[model samples]
Target: MNLFKMLRCAFLLMPALFCYSQTSSGSTAVVSLEICSNESSVDLFTMLNADAVAGGVWSPSLSGGQGIFNPAVDNEGTYLYTVTTNYVTLYEVEVEVSVVDPIAATTTSTTLCSNAGPVDLIGFTNDTSNQGTWVPELSSGTSVFNPSVDEPGIYSYIASGACGTTVSEVYVEVIDTANSGISTSLSICEGSSPFNLFDALEGSPDLGGTWSPPLRNGSGYFDPQRDAPGVYSYTVGNDYCGYSSASVTVSIDQSPFAGSDAVADLCVNNGPVDLYAFLGDGPDAGGSWSPALSGGSGWFDPLTDQEGVYTYTISNGSCGMDTATVEVRLIDTNNQPNVSLAITDLSGNNSIHVQIPNRTNYHYSLDNINYQSSNSFTNLSGGKYTVYIREIEGCGFFHKEVVLLGGPKFFTPNGDGINDYWSLFDISNIDYTIKVFDRYGRPIDTFDNHSIGWDGTFNGNPLPSADYWFLVNFEDGTTKNGHFTLLR
Candidate 1:
């Protein structure tokens, strides 16, 4: 009976030994795993036990299963497990639990035209790791990204998890360069006409741009209807990209109304009359007129008034003139024609001529009682004589005093030959002293001697029959300067 009791006690302790051995087996080791939240990259942490199991019962203590470890997160072979047991026996088994971070996410950097707004990258992420947590390095929640920088730079994004983190960068560039140019045409001349360049740069962009050739009639923009002829320039640009410029040449035409001439007529009767002119036609055509007149409808007539000849001129609007002239006369009214006599020989050598009214019959003689068909008489004796003229109902006479004092007829100094030298008349009683001068004002001769008479010679050279000046002192104390022709 005592031997039976000892065997029974051994059988009771066997279950307890199995439980201890299983708990201390290799299956009781702790294991762990990690995963990135953004990229889903996984990492494994394995714990191996040092004891072997004898029974098939295993268990693990809470304190023994807890420990810190580091693992590399990657896509290759991500599964991990661990067994837990009580004591040295394999009593129970348990698998390891892994805590994965949210999947890592990534975003593509954006490219935009210059001046375009910022890009939104809020929802961009990498979900390969099945992680929910995402974080940004360059920006915060709902932050925008701007790739349009003044200078080129790189953009970056980063995601992290309990296991690891990832980094990505994208190159970005901003450009605002543009082609700038201009064009225009112009017409010019030598006058005061308005210039225009409005038509230049038509069909061009003007928003956020500036135009030159400042507006004369409208805004600074070049509009064909607004600008005058001239030169112009234009510029355009963006806030981030800066600006560009272009030049345009404009031309304007000369006015047709330049340099016009005006003309009018001034008549004796009509003071000033309108004279129509063509634009640059006649000597005085083509001009503007005050109180305007119709073309070719202006004129003047002299019979309208009795005033003297009227005058007018054609002028260049600024300077210069062309002129014209006219004349008038009187009429005669008488039944008996008028007649007059004249002497042609002013030197008084017995030569004479006459003139009579047109369409008249007349005659003349040296005596009042005598009449002849001859109209002239010549070479008569040097004495007082009467000249008579006879018309149909009347006869008229004129008398002239003549004295042949110093010629061959009166002062003949006859010796055996007749009339050879000159002799003095008895003019001493008339209080006369004759003096003669040469052409150069030199006193050459004087007639104070009673018997001295000139023989028409100077310095023994016979004087020619030409006019010579003489001085005669009269009895009245007045001097007479006379011009006479000498006769040979």
Candidate 2:
């Protein structure tokens, strides 16, 4: 070292080399230093004043005159360096050493979602010294950790005090939160085909989530025919966050089924009948009828209703509606026939002709099963008969009971037991108004069905034997007008 000082003295002409040699000329300097206990040994010469010279010996004698200060081994106090010539002190400097135990390097861990806001990386550690710098530098060029932009890992926070640098490890784990996507609603027909429920979601959803109230097959597929319609939920989770859930509302619509068409027969005078009774099979209820009725119901009134095709309709929202038709026909029971039969009963030509206004519009039948277009029906003998008259246009049929009187053509009212009175045959209990007129059509007699036969007399006087015309008026607006002979 002495030889080195002599070389520095030879270069005194260079001011940069010989300017700091003023310490050898009896100069005093002092300095204070705070160093970390874990730091490397510091140079005592560097801590001294800039004008201080080298080749100084420390009071706490360092080996080899190195002027090194080690905080780990040295105590916290003032360290003195002295320079002497011939054992007389020429320069002296004080170095106050402060040993600051490394800010207690902490190991901390923090978990955050990638969507979390920015935070100070050093805040996770217990160290209150805000002088930490992150390793691989924070992307924001600051100590604030932005989880969205910065990569997450073990970040070493190097904090520096006046002492030295301390390393803190921040185990940062930035994870993505579970996303179950957006909630939505869907409506499908009850018998619709199967489809994936995940596809029905609104936004971009995370996959591999479980469905609540699990589907029939334990999958995201929704089968309208098999699955019960209601709300379903999708849940996703991890160890970090508990869980996240979203719902999908599924609504099933019922299909509309209208029954088969039918034909009905109604009587004009039979009042109203329910049109639903005419449907074929299991028809859906609560339907509407076309050609709206006055009563707003399915009842059809033969008196005031139109006869055609009536339609029934059943509706089901977006699934559309179904329709069926009911054909209606009306029968006319009005204007029933009142007939007058001319029978040649005594001569054995027992033939009767039906009399009606419009014979063309009616068909005649003695037995209801057999019908004929002709109004005349003939046979040998007759007592009582039922005449059936049906409309040719499929309206309806009408039947009437009539007595074919088979009595003598000429009646002798001579008070004898054999031919005592002239009256209708086989009509003892029938009620009728009988009028006997002479050849000039004069009124003669009137009797009821409960009375005895006519005595062939006018005003208690015996009438002369002659051809007289008798008219029978029935209660049902039918009249039997014919000629009969009366003998005195």
Candidate 3:
């Protein structure tokens, strides 16, 4: 050993390096330890106050001059030390040591069912000095250290400890035990009030629950009228457990019309109108027709359908349905009249009488060319005349030729049921005169009116077979003259 080296071992009581240099003035040397294990040896010679040393030993050490201050052993309290120097000044090196583990982490997390209740983060930490706190505090400090309700995710915990604050991460994973039993989809009528999805969830946690893309009522209720149709998500968390999520689907269904009533009018002979044509838009359009049908489905057929009231119903989805009531009526206009004639005696007049029901809307005319409001014609000659009947209300008219009763010129008075008398069939109450003459235009037999007709004879006796001439006057202002043959 060198002379100085030998002297350093003899004076120092602990393991360390001793260096000595002969000089009039002394200089200081600073030593530093950048990295170290849990417990490590610190060099005492490198931290000497001066390069020149006579002899020295550190106090508080039994057999070593090495000063040791480990964060693990002494905690965070201070440990004082002093070194006595046998030379001009004391050769001492002051050092501070800390034991900070790079990766020392105990699970600061605990788990619970979503409904289990608040989690105590303080109880979960193994670190003696500090209580753990959750980062990104839930709902802004509402669930900071509480598990009662928290957002579900990987949460970090920082526990202040004696050996340099160590970070312990706690993984809180929440299970949907409460909401798993409930249904996720629901339906509501359109234009209706919003329904709350939270109300449907079973056993769900009351706290730490949040809805995404919130609704007007703050995310829980679904309004079909104002909200867009889509799926919504809900998340619930507890401090003890992480978090759970569920989806809800909001479906809007169409509603039926409030009321449908219709009325219509058809000409007496017109038709059955198509019921669906009058019905406009509705919830359930193109619906089925009731009461069965023929070739025309959903149509009203005038030929087969009777004139009456009817109904159409629109059946919506499932049991929803709407009914429409319809009323139908008809307008009638037609006149059919009965015609009769009355004959008068001597005056050769015939009265034409027309019988019509409800004369209020009817008019009659004896001549087809002209029309009159009267229903009777008087003093008409023996001839066929066309009569016109008109109903003015509906602008409908009828025309027909009427035959007037006239006397036959000749007849066989021999009786045997053959042309035994000269008579007129359709005689009226008007005056009429018939004169039967011989070959010469002399008057022989006379007849007047519908009460009597001339037999082919002079007085009451039968006439011989010969040609006869006759002159008859009608009740009207006209007369009839004719000739005929009499056989005996």
Q: Please state every model's RMSD to the true fold in angstroms.
A: 21.4, 12.1, 17.1
lDDT of 1 by residue, 1-488 (tens): 11110011111121111001112234333222222223221212212232323233212222223322222322222222333364333332332434344334354554455666666444344534323332332343333555453334554545444434555444455665533445545434424334333344545543445667566654544434345555567677765666777666654332333223433323232223444432244444443333222232333333443323323334442123444322221122234345545543223455434456631465656655566666766654333334655553332223342222333332232334554544334343344566776566666567743645665677876666555565656555655454444554
- Winning candidate number (lDDT): 2
User: What does candidate 2 score on TM?
Assistant: 0.48
Q: Which scores higher on lDDT, 1 or 3?
A: 3
lDDT of 1 at 334: 30
lDDT of each: 0.41, 0.74, 0.55
> Which ranges in model 2 have alpha carbons more than 4 Å from their true place?
1-32, 35-43, 46-65, 68-109, 112-122, 125-188, 195-209, 229-233, 236-239, 244-253, 263-270, 329-394, 397-488
**Model 3, residue 469: what's the lDDT?**
76
TM-score of each: 0.30, 0.48, 0.32
Better of 1 and 3 by TM-score: 3
- What are the per-residue Cα lDDT tens digits for candidate 3 across 208-302? 46777788777688877787767777776544445567767767777766236666555454445666665655525666555644434656665
- How many clashes show up in model 3? 34
Candidate 1 lDDT: 0.41
Better by lDDT, candidate 3 or 2: 2
Q: How far does residue 45 in candidate 2 sit from its true spot (Å)?
A: 4.0
Model 3 global lDDT (CA atoms, 0 to 1): 0.55
For each candidate, how many residue pairs have backbone atoms clashing (under 3 Å)? 57, 0, 34
